[model samples]
Target chain A: MRAAVCIALAVVAVAACACRIPEDPDGTLDRVEGGVMRVGITESDPWVELEGGVPTGGVEVRLVRRFARDLGARIEWVDGSEEELVDALKEGSLDLVIGGLTSKSRWKKDAAFTRPYVETTTVVGVPAGSSLPDDLDGVTVAAELGTEAEALVDAKTDADVRPVRDLGRAHGEPAAAHDYVLDDLGLAAGTELKEDKHVMAARLGENAFLVRLERFLLGRSEEIERMLRKEGRP
Target chain B: MTDRRETEGPFRRFELPEELLPEQRKAVRLEWLTLVYMLSAVVLLALTLGQSQAMKAAWIEDLLSLLPPAAFLIASAMRTRDPSAKFPWGFHRSVSVAYVFAALALLVMGAYVFFDSAFKLVTAERPPIGVIQLFGEEIWLGWVMIGALVYSGLPAVFLGRAKLKLADELHDKVLYADAQMNKADWMTVSAAIVGILGIGVGLWWADAVAAIFISLDILHDGWKNMRASVHDLMDARPRRHDAREFHPIVDRIEDELRKLDWIEDGAVRLREEGHVFTGEVLVVPREDDHLVDRLEELAHHLLSLEWKVYDIVVVPVREIDIPSRDGRPRSSAVGEEPARSP
Candidate 1:
């Protein structure tokens, strides 16, 4: 009984500890202020890329800009290679990383991925005259290097897969002239291709941030779909 | 000190036994001191009000000045009175009523200062000059007010401390309530200090605004104290074990009493009327004659605790073995009766 009373008191004390006021009287910021928001963007097409040394707009860029304004912070865009983006996040050089990145098993060890904003599908686009390999047995499928789509091809088939600099290049006319272009773009790309789907990809630990960005894009998805259709047209 | 035959006068006919310890006498003496201090402050404030000439000052003074005298007069009267025909519980409620009246007056004074100052702040085209002076020099009236507050506040702090001690010793609701009122005086004094500082800073409306804030605080405190006093007076069940020190002792007693399987469905209620613990155990007795003796021994064990345990009453309830419709004997049961006062 003494033990029980002591245990009860201990439980109360633990509960009291949780609710103890922080020594610093000032409260935690529900709204952010007073810092440069370092946003890491992979140099992927349409979503993010440097055009003439000026970082141009994309679905992710517009989404983050609004968040920056609300937070009273300046947006410092840090463009990097896909691997460097993850490296920058790990090194604490970047607060966030955004691109057409999917939360796949391969990236799980490196970075945290936010919830999917959009779903994409895997599709193969061959030239009008060229015979396409259905099984991808001996044929090479062109995919963006270090992408989830490339990983899927590596996982699913023993096909000869060639890596492209970007998915945009893979889905372009020149790359399409080669074997088959596995269009590993977002669901918008799939709807545009009408023959395939693309899985949207994001870095890790950004589920809420990605969800918010995706919702914002989803609100203006029609315009984005039109742009993707125009950009990726073979 | 007076003869018993002269009891018809405005004095007590009965005397308490000389057996009361020195500490108990000290408690009574302090209670009297609390009354006297409150009354004197009231008289001083009242005279100050009468002596002032300005319309606003005099009016505010008249309102603010009534609290201490009223509280003292009524609480003292209640303390001295005998149990009457109409009120079987005597006029103990007079303390609460007196506190209520005093609190109400303080609230009014606070509000008056708040509103009057706020009005001047908003509407006055020109800042009013500090006109009132008490001595030969042009004494800063605000400073004088602050000084008066300090004079009232310091004494009240001591009085309140003494009253709280008295309340603890005698289990007195009135003195404790007065102690609460005294706590409010500290806030009032603080407000006066700020008000004076604000005046010197050329924010002529500061004093009044501070008073208003102070008033609201007093009102809240007054309402709470009154509510508590009323609740206590209405024979509110004594809190069992809110104190930290006595909780372990109480828990032991409760656990021990509960161990007897035959003593089914009971609670041990403990209360502190003064510094003494008064406990009642509602119990179901077993068939064995030794059960009562054992319970008495347990009660004695509780009384022998280092903490103050004045009395213990073990209320034994006979276990009625009521048979079910199918003629099966029921389990042991207990019910409450007013446990005999220890």
Candidate 2:
């Protein structure tokens, strides 16, 4: 019995020695500083536009790029659908998700959003020669699936709502896609549907990344406003 | 002439009850296992902290619970040491002391948890929890909390169950108390898990509410253990589960004493010293010429019981009836009255 106890104690000591040292108490901050920051990006124009199948410059893309540089880390972007991106953020696979996401998102419970960097209104696009209605009483309004515009139309309008794959092509040739489709399709921009504050989403409780992004957005509001006017304006 | 028997202190090497050796060995083994379990629990707890307030509280409780098994292990080892000049009753009382100490530690921890959780509830403090991003997936704080609860809770249940039978067989109150703590530990962890899941579901108060219930359970266990250990330390006769009656061993001793011819009547007192009993027998000896020899025989017979009755002073006396306040004679039944048992 004595020998067994001695052996057990010795084993315990060795096991204790071999035990993993606890991770840094400030996990998110340490992770950010450890080199790679995984970012989830959805395909949205003027925020995360694709050029020849490669992600190119956009308002949010540039902002996050600077933010990543500030953290002394390079961004590793994972492209997915908005819901998939939010799910990835919640599962800790993505540090942050960007692509013109808004502060008021259905996935807010699973992901934390930075303060709004830009506020834009959802507008109805009609053919350029068509008369726009004050209210969508009998209009056939189209919104992309899973977008705030879909929710806004559902809540505020008694219109014949049509769920579309691409809002830009909803009023024109199905293959046509552009930054703002109203002019290209000879459609007219109509009444503002809903105002949304564009924000960046991060994994819930990734306070370090969220705070840093919020601070960067706050500090660079003027620069972002200029960038929006140049490329984000519609 | 030297009094050879007088040299035998209460600490003198007395044979352990033959049936208890295996149980004692089992108890030792169980304690070692408990120690290992607790050590791993501590490691897991450290790894799992900062997940949620409920998780943190459970971890702290786990840390505090390490005391009982450690005290039991040391006491169990020391309790078998032979009697020395300094400790006349041998080291058996070390078990009692360990029991009291362990109980006191539990009480302190329970009080701490109770107050801390109550204060949080009163202040309406919502603990801030973080999510860990794994492989591009955001895992909510609740999943981590569930993982932590399972890690800390499962082993406690096993250890608690493993120790209980050994505690009962050896009649080791300290080990029994430790086992009870281990049992309570898993329950506390479960409550913590519920609390964390509640937090996940956006019921901010659920965590504190669950914590309060956990604290209350701990406090209840603490009070019970403290009362039992304190009773043991005070040399109170060990009682049955009903608490109103003495252990059946006391009844057996009294019945056997009453059956003896020379022991016309007797009063038996039994008190537990650690795992054994030590007491006195006041016998109303019959008018026999060999009264001294009869008294010795009765003492030997009393000691021979399987109840670990290590010390018995057989005092021979004449019947003395006391009158009640109303002038009626009071019945003197053996083992019916309270007396000091050392």
**Quick one: best TM-score, which candidate?**
2
Candidate 1 lDDT for residue B103: 56
| Cα-based lDDT for every prediction | 0.48, 0.67
State every prediction's TM-score relative to the real structure: 0.39, 0.56
Q: What C-alpha lDDT, on a 0 to 100 scale, does residue A177 get in candidate 2?
A: 22
TM-score attained by model 1 = 0.39
lDDT of 2 by residue, B1-342 (tens): 001122256443543565677777777787787788777877876765653556766876787678788887887778779877888667888877887877777778778877887887796554445444446454544565567677777778778878877766665667777787787676787678767655544455667787777777767877888898889878777775324456777778878976777666676666788777777777776566787777777777777675566678777555424332235664664433434221
Q: Which candidate is the best by DockQ?
A: 2
For A141-195, candidate 2 gives per-residue lDDT tens digits of: 7777777677777677666667888664564421112224345445556666767
Error of 1 at B318 (Å): 5.7
Query: Residue by residue across A1-234, what tens digits does model 1's lDDT show?
Result: 354354335334533664321111111111124567677776555455567535676655665687677667787877777678777765546666766565463544455443344443454444445654555577676666776556666566556678888555454321221112233332111101222222233333232333333334444446556555444333
